[model samples]
Target: MENKIKLLYMLQTLDLKLMDLEEEKGDLPGIVQNLNDQINELQAQIDELRKQINEHTSTREQSNLDAETLNQRVESLKKQLYEVRNNKEYDAITKEIAEAEENIMAKMQNAEEHDDKQKELSANVDELKQKYESLQSELQDNQKDLQEVSKVHEDEELQLKHERDKIARQLPQETLVSYDRIRSAKYGKAVVPITRGACGGCYKTVPPQLNLLLRKNDEILHCENCGRILIAEEIAAEVNKVA
Candidate 1:
C-alpha cells in the first residue's frame, strides 16, 4: 500500500509536468483545430457544389443533343409532305412535323434551364472556395505557431509522459481509474500531500485521526471537501527527490 501511494504521487508529478508543458503553448492548438474543421466543412460544400454543377452541365448537353435530333426529324418530315399523294398521308406528314418542332422547343427550353442552374452552382462553388482558402491560410498560421511552441518542449514532454505511463502501470487498475477520475474532476490535481495538517488541494484542515492514518500510507484516503487523494508529506518529499 505504501509503495502504491508513492507510485501514484510520482505519476501525478509527471502528469502535472506534462500539463505544464502543454499549457505553455497557450490556445494555439485549439485555434488550429477549429480552423482545420472550418476548412474541411468548406471544402465539402465546395465539392458538393462542383458535383451539382457537373450534373447540370451533363443535363444541358443532353437536352441540346435531343433538340438537334428533333430539328433533323422535322426537316425530313417536311420533305415527305411534298411526296404525299392522299390528303390522309399529307395530314400525317404535317402532324409529324408539328410534333417534332414542339419537341425541339421543349428540349431547347430544358437546356436553357439547366445552363442557368449550372452557372448558379458554379458561382456558389467559387464563393465557397474563397472561404476555404481563407480558412486554410489561418489554419496554416496557427499550425505553424503551435509547431514552434511544441518544438520547445517536445523532448521533455515525451520523457515526462513515458515516466507517467510507467508509474501508472505500477498502480492497481482501480486506484489508477479513481485517480484519473478525480484528476479530471478537480482540474488535473488528483493526489495532494498534507500541508500543516490540512488538505493540500482544498486547504481544509485534516482531522487528526485521518492525518495519522495517512502517515501510515496503508490505504487510499480522500478529502471530504474536495475528494482529492491525500498523501503524507514525507512520502511526497521522498518521491519528489527520486522522481
Candidate 2:
C-alpha cells in the first residue's frame, strides 16, 4: 500500500481507540443518572414512612384526649348521683353514671388500640429509617465510585485525544478527512488487514492480481464489498514496529 494509506490505517487505529474511550465516558453519565434515581426512590420511601408514623402518633393522641373527656363526664355523673333526692331521680342518675362509665371504658380501649398501632408504626418507621441510612450510604459510595471512574476516564480520554492530535499533524488533511469519514461509516473501523486472500473487513474474496499489487505496497487497496482500506499483514507488522 502507499505510505499515505498506511498512515491512514494508523489514523484509523487512533480513531477507534478514541471512539472506545468516548463511548465509555458517555456511559458514565447514564450510570450516574440511574444511581440518582435509586437514591430518589429511597428518599421518597423514607418520607412516606415518616408521614405514616406522624399520622399514627396524631391518632393516638386524639384517642387519649377522647378517653380523658369521657373520664370527666363520668366524674360529673357521679356528682349528680350524690345530689339526687327522689328514688326515680336516683335511678336516673345511676343509669347516667353507668352509661358514662361504659363510654369511658370504650374510649380507653380505643386509646389503647391507637397507642398499640402507634408503637407498631413507630417501629416500622425506625426499621425503614435504618434501611434508608444503609441505602444512602451505598448511594454515596456509588456516587464516589462514579466520580472516580469519570475522572480516570476523562484523563485517559484526554491522553487519547492528545495522541490522535499528534497523529493528525503527521497526516495530510485530505487523508485524515477520508479516515474520519470511513471510520464513522464503518463504526470506528476504517481499516482492515487482508488475510488468506480475503478482505478482512467484509470477508469477500479479493482478485488475485490486485492481491499481488497490495503485497507490492505501491497503492492503497480498498475492499469492494465493504469499502474499507486494506492492509496486508507483513506490511502492517513492519509499520507497527515503526509506529
Candidate 3:
C-alpha cells in the first residue's frame, strides 16, 4: 500500500509538470494567430483606402477633361460673337459663352474637390502602410520566438511525457482511472498529504481514526471533504526519499 501510494504521488507530480509545460506551449499558437489576424485586418484597410484613392483620381481626370472641353466651347462662342449679323445674334452668342464659362467653372470646382479627397486618401494609405509594416514585423518576431521556444522545450517535454506514461503504466488500471478522474475534477490534484492533521487538498480536519489509519499505511484512504487520496507523513517521507 505504501509503495502504491508513493507511485500515485510520483505520477501526480509528473502529470502536473506535464500540464504546466503544455500550458506554456499552448499560448504561442494563439499569439501567432492573433498577430496574423491583426496584420490581415490592417491589409484590408489599406486596400480599401487605395481603392478609394484610385476612384477619386479617375474622377478628377474626367472632370479636368470636361472643364477643358467647356472652355474650348466658350472660346468658340466668343469668336462667333464678332461674326454676328445683328444685336440679337450677338446677344445669343454672348449668352452661350456665359453658360459655357459657368459649366467650366463647376467642372473645375469638382476637379479641385476630387484632388483634395485624393490627397486625404493618399495620406491615410501612407499611415496604414506604416501600421501594416509594424504589425508584419511584430508577427514575424512572434513566430520566431515561438519556434525558438518549441525548439528549446521539445526534448524536455517529450521526456516528461515519457516518464509520466511509464509511471502511469505501473499503477493498476482502476487506480489510474480514478486518479485521472479526480485530477480532472479537482484541477490536477488527485493525491495530497495530510498536513497539520487536516486534508491538504481541502483543509478539512481529519477524524482521529482516519488519521490513525492513514499513518498505518495499511490501505488507501480518501479525504472525506475533497475526495482526494490522503497520504500520511511517514509515507510521504518514504516517497520523497525514493524520489
True lDDT of residue 54, candidate 1: 90
lDDT of all the models against the reference? 0.88, 0.75, 0.85
After best superposition, candidate 2 residue 228: deviation in angstroms? 15
For candidate 2, the per-residue lDDT at 54 reads 77
Best candidate according to lDDT = 1
- Cα RMSD for candidates in order: 2.2, 8.3, 6.8
Candidate with better TM-score, 2 vs 3: 3
Candidate 1, residues 107-171: lDDT per residue as tens digits? Answer: 99999999999999888888888888888888888888999999999999888888777777777
Displacement of the residue 203 alpha carbon in candidate 2, Å? 8.6
**TM-score list, all predictions:** 0.89, 0.54, 0.59
- Model 1, which residues run further than 4 Å from truth? 204-208, 241-243
Backbone clashes in candidate 3 total 0
List residue ranges in candidate 3 displaced over 4 A: 1-19, 155-243
Predicted structure 1: lDDT: 0.88
Better of 2 and 3 by lDDT: 3
Clashing pairs in 3: none
Report the Cα lDDT for residue 53, model 3.
Answer: 91
